[model samples]
Target: MNANELTIAEARDALAGGELSAVDLTMACLTAIDAGTPLNAFVHATPEIALDQARAADARRGADAGALNGIPLGIKDLFCTKGVASQAASNILKGFKPEYESTVTSKLFEAGAVMLGKLNMDEFAMGSSNETSCYGDAVNPWKVDDRRLTPGGSSGGSAAAVAADLCLGATGTDTGGSIRQPAAFTGIVGIKPTYGRVSRWGIVAFASSLDQAGPMTKSVRDAAILLGAMAGHDPKDSTSADIPVPDFEAALTGDIRGKKIGIPREYRMDGMPAEIEALWARGREMLADAGAEIVDISLPHTKYALPAYYVIAPAEASSNLARYDGVRYGHRARLGQGDGIVDMYEKTRAEGFGKEVQRRVMIGTYVLSAGFYDAYYNRARKVRALIKRDFDEAFAAGVDAILTPATPSSAFGLGEMAEADPVAMYLNDVFTVTVNLAGLPGISVPVGLDAKGLPLGLQLIGRPWDEAGLLNHAHVLERAAGFVEKPRKWW
Candidate 1:
C-alpha cells in the first residue's frame, strides 16, 4: 500500500518501527495531491513546507516524538496558517495570509504533523454545496457516469483530500453540517467536537457560537487520533473550555454494549429517499447487533432547526464578517475619484463577497435590524434554546447517544441544487444543524452505499463533552457495518 493511503495509526506504527520515514509518507501524499489536482481538493499545495516538516519530524523521532508525529494533513482554508493563504475560499480574503497560526494548527504542528496545504471551503463557510467557493467546487472522488458530484461543503476540500488519500487527515471546521455532511458525502469520518471543545482561536469566524474545528479522515480511528492533537484548551479563545482533552484514540474500545442509542423519530422526514431510510435502518441494526439498545425518542423542536440555524448562523456571520472592509488586509476595492471611506467599504464588500455570502449577510443585517430583531433573530434564539432543550431531555432520559442519518441523501451533482431555490440547498443540513445548536459532539460514520454506489453515513450525536463515548459508539458501528469501499481513482 502507498504511504499516503496509510491511516494515522498505521503510519504512526510504521514510522516508529523504522519501516517508513516521514519524508517518504509526505512525498507519497504530495504525489497523490499532484495527481488529484483535477478534484481541486487542495487549493494550495505546500510541498516545500511539507518536506521541511517531514525532515524535522524524522530528526525528532525518539522518545520525545508527539502523538501526531509525521502525519501529513490538509488544513481547511478557514484556518489562519502563518504565511499561507487562508482565504476561507472567499474572494474578499484573497491574498490574505495570516502572521500567526490557528490554535488547532499550532497544536498539530507541535505534535509534529506536516501541512500539505490549505484545502478549499465555502465563501465564509456560507453554503451547503462547494459551488459557493471562490476556488470552484471540490469534486467528490466518488463518481457515476461522467457527471461531477459535490464533495459537500464548506469542508468539501478536506473531505475530498482525506477520502482520496491525498493526506492522512485534514482539519475541518464545522458550522452547521460542514464537517459531518461532507464526510458522509465522501465516505469518510468527520467529527465535530462539542462547541468549545477545540479552541477556535485563529480560525476565521463563521458563527462564533457554532463553529468548531475537527478532523476529517479515512476512518473513525484516524478521526480520533487527529482530533486528539487538534483539541485542547487555549488561553487565547475565551470560549475554549479549561477541561482536559482525553486520549481519544485509547477511548475507542469498540464496545458499545448496554449503550442507549436514541433513534429520533423526528429525523425520519417525509419525502426522504428510500436509500437513506434503508441506510438508517441498517445503521440501527448494526448498533443493535453490537449490543446497543436502540430506543425511539423525540426531539420535537427539530422541525425548527433549519430555520433557526439559518437565522442564527447568518446573524453571527454578519457580525463576524464586518471586519473585512478595504482598510484592513486582504482584497481592497480600488476607489473612484470621489469615493469616500463608506463607498470603499461598500464597493470592497460587494466586490469581495460571493452571492451566497452577500445573501446571508443581508439576511443577517436585516434580522439584526432594530425593527426585525425580535421578530427574527431573537425568536430564532428562543427556538435554538428549545432545540437544545430537546437534546438535553433525551440525554436526561438515559440516552447515551443519538443516532440519525448524517444527510438526507448521498452526494449530489455539483450544480444539482445550486440554481434551485436556496431553501433546497439549505435542506442538505437538516440532520446536522441540531448538534451544533445543542453544543454537542457529533460524528458521521460511513455505514453503507446507495443504489448508485455512493456512500451514506449515520450520525452519532453524544452528550456535551462526551466525544470519547460518541467515538466509541461510532467505532462499533463502523466495525459492524464493514464499509471498506473506496472511491475509484477517477480523479
Candidate 2:
C-alpha cells in the first residue's frame, strides 16, 4: 500500500511494531506530493519542518507514544498557525499570519502527529467544485479519461491530497457539505461531527454556526483516529462542546450486528443518477449482510433542508465576514486622499471577495434586512429546527443511522457544469446538507464505482455526537464494499 494511503489503525500497528518510522512515512508522502504537483493537490509544503516534526515523533515513541505518535498529517489552509500563511485560500488574507494556532491544529500537534504543511481549499471555503480556489483546483485521480473531476470543495485539496497519497489525513471544514461531498468525490472517507463538537477558535470564520473542522482520510479507522486527535473541548471557543471526548479508535469493533439502519426514502430524488441509486441500494444490502436491519423512513423536512441551509449559512457568513472591512486586517485597498471610510470598505471588499462570495453576502444582508428578515431568515431557522427534529425522531424510533448516497452523481468533468445555474450546484449538496442543518454527525465512504470508473459514495448519518457509531458503520460498509484500494494515477 502507498505510505500516505495507510489507514490510521494500520499505520499505528506498524509503527508500534517498529516497521515504519514517522520520518519514513513523511518522506514517502513528500515524494508522492512531488510526483503529484501536476495534479495541483498541494498549494504549499514545508518539507524540512515536516521532517523535523517526524523526527521528534520517532524520538518520543517509546516514552510517551500516543495513538498518532508517528503519524504524518495535513492541515487545511483555513486554520491559523502561528507562522504559517493561514490564508483561507483567498487573496484577502494573503499575508495574514496568526500569532496563535487553531484549536484542532494545536491538538493534532499535541497528539504527536507530524504536520505536513497547509493544503489548498476553495477561497473562504465557499465553493462546491473547488474551482473557486485562489490556488488551482485539485484534480480527482480516478477519472477513466484523466479529465478533471472536481475533488469537490471547499475541502477539495484535502480530499485530493489524501486520495492521491499526498497526506495521510488532512483536516477539513464543513459548513454545508465541504467535508463529506469532497470525500465522496475523491473516494475517501470524511466525517463532519455534530456542530460545536470540534473547537473553532483561530479557524477563519465562514459561518459561525455551521463551520466545523473534521478529518479526511482513506478509511473509517483513520477517520476515527484523526477525530480522536482533533476533537475535544477548548476553553478558547465558548461554543466548543464540553462533553467528554470518547476514544473513537476504540469504538471500531467492525461488528454492527443487530443495528437498525434507516434508509430514508425521501432522499432518493428525481434525476439522481441511476448508478448512485443502485449504489445506495447496494449499501443497504451490505449493511443487511452484516446483520443490520434496514428500514424505510421519511425525513419529512427533506425538501426544506437545502433552502433552509442556504439561507442560514450565508446569513452567518455575512455577519462573520463583516470583520474584514480592510482596515484592521485583510487586504486593505490603496485609497487616494479624501477617500471616505465607507468607500474604503466597498473598494476593499470588492477587491477581496470572489463573485460567488459577494453574491452570497449580498443575499445574506438582504435577507437579514428589515424587509425580508421574517420572510426568509426566520423561516429558515424554523425549518432548520424541523430538520433537527426529524433526525431526532428517527433516532428515537431506533434507527442507528441513516444511509443515503453522499452525492447525487459522480464527479463531473471540469467546466462540464460551469454554465449551470448556481441552484444546480447547490442541489449537488441536497443529500448532505440536511445532515448539517440537523447538526448530526455524518460520514461518506466509498461504496462502488460508476460505469465510467469514477468512485461513488454512500453516506451514513448518525444521531448527535454519534461519530463512533457512524465510523463503525462506515467500516462495516467499507469492508463489505471493498472500495479502499488505491486509485490509478494519471500523472
Candidate 3:
C-alpha cells in the first residue's frame, strides 16, 4: 500500500519500525500531489520546508521519539503557519503570512509531524463547495461517473488531498459540516473535536462559537491519532477548555458492543436520496449486528437548526470579517478617481470579498440591525438553545450517540449544483449543520460507495466532550465497512 493509504497509526508503526522514513512518505505525497494537480486540491506547497521537516522527523525517529514521529500532513490554509501564506483561500488576504503558528500546527510540529503545504478551502470557510475559493475549487477524487465531482466544501481541498493520497492526513475546520461533508464526498474520516476541546487561536475565525479544527484521514483510528496531537488547551485562546486530553489513539478498540445509537427522525427528510437512506439502514444494521441497539429519537428542533446556523454563523462572521477592512490590514482596493475616504473603504471592501461573502455580510448586518434583531438574530439564538436541549435529552435517555447521513448524496459534479439555484447547494448541508448549531462533536466515516461508485458516508454525533465515544463507534463501523484497500479514478 502507498504511504498515504496507510492510516496515521499504521504509518506511525511503520516509521517507528524503520520500514518507512518521513522523507520517503513525504516524497510519495509530493508525487501524488504532482499527479493530482489537475484536481487543484492544494493551493500551495513548500517542497524545501517539507523536506526539512521530514529530516527533523527522521532525526527524532532515530532517537526513539513520540507517537506521531514521522507522519506527513497537509494543513488547511485556514490554519496560520508561521512564514507561510495563511490565506483562507481568499484573495482578500492574498499575500498575508502570519508570524505565529496556530496552536494545532505548533502542537503537530512538537509531535514530529511534517508539514507538506497549505491546502485550499472555501473563502473564509463559508461555502458548501470549494467553488468559493479564490484559489479554485478542489475536484472530488471520486467517480459519480466520468464527470467532475465536488469534494464537498470548506474542507474540500483537505478531503480531496487525503482521498487522492496526496497527503496522509489533513487539517480541516468545521463550522457547519465543513470537515465531515467533504470527508463524505471524498471517502475519508473527518472528526470535529468537541467545541472548545481544541484551541481556536490562529485558526482564522469563521463562526467563533462553532468553528473547530480537526483531522481528515483514512480511518477512525488515524483520525484519533491526529486529533490527539492537535488538541490541547492554550493560554492564547481563552475559550479553549482546560479538560484533560484522553488517549484517543488507544481508544480505537474496533468494538462498539453494548452501545445505544439513536436515529433522529427529523434527519430523514423527503429529499434524501434513496441510496442514502439504504446506507443509513445498512449502517444501523451493522451496528446492531455488533451487539448494539438502535432507537428512533426526536430532535424536534432539527428543522430550526440550519436556519439558526445560517443566522448565527453569519452574524459572527460579519463581526469577525469586519477586521478585514482596508484600514490597517488585508487587501486594500485602489480608490476611484476623486473618491473620498469613505469611498476608499467602500472600494477596498468591494474588491476584497466575493459576492457570497458580501451577501452574507449584508444579511448578517441586516439581521443584527435594530429593526431585525429580534425577528431574525434573536429568534435564531433561542432556537439554538432548543437544539442543544434536544441533544442533551437524547443523551440523557441512554443514547450514546446520534447517527445520520453525512451528506444527502454522494459527490456531485463540480458545477452541477453550483450552477443550479444556490439554495440547492445550501440544502446539501441540511443533514450536518445541526451538530454545529448544537456545539456538539461529530465525525464522518466512509461507509460505502453509492450505485454510481462515489463514496457515501455515515455521521456520528456525540454530546459535548464525547468525541472518544463517537470515535470508538466509528472505528468499529470503519472496520466493518472496509471500503479502503482500493482506489478509484478521480472525477
Give the candidate number with the greatest TM-score: 1
User: Positional deviation of 182 in candidate 2, in angstroms?
Assistant: 0.8
Estimate the overall C-alpha local distance difference test score of candidate 1: 0.93
lDDT of each: 0.93, 0.87, 0.87
Error of 2 at 438 (Å): 0.8
Candidate 1: tens digits of C-alpha lDDT, residues 19-90: 999999999999999999999989988999999999999999989999989999999999999999999999
lDDT of 3 by residue, 397-475 (tens): 9999888999988888878877678778888789888888888899999999888777889999987897888899998
Candidate 2 TM-score over all chains jointly? 0.98
Rank order by lDDT, top first? 1, 3, 2
TM-score, model 1 to reference: 0.99
Give me the displacement of residue 269 in model 3, in angstroms.
0.7
Q: Candidate 3 vs. truth: CA RMSD?
A: 1.4
Each candidate structure's TM-score, on Cα atoms with residue i matched to residue i, is 0.99, 0.98, 0.97
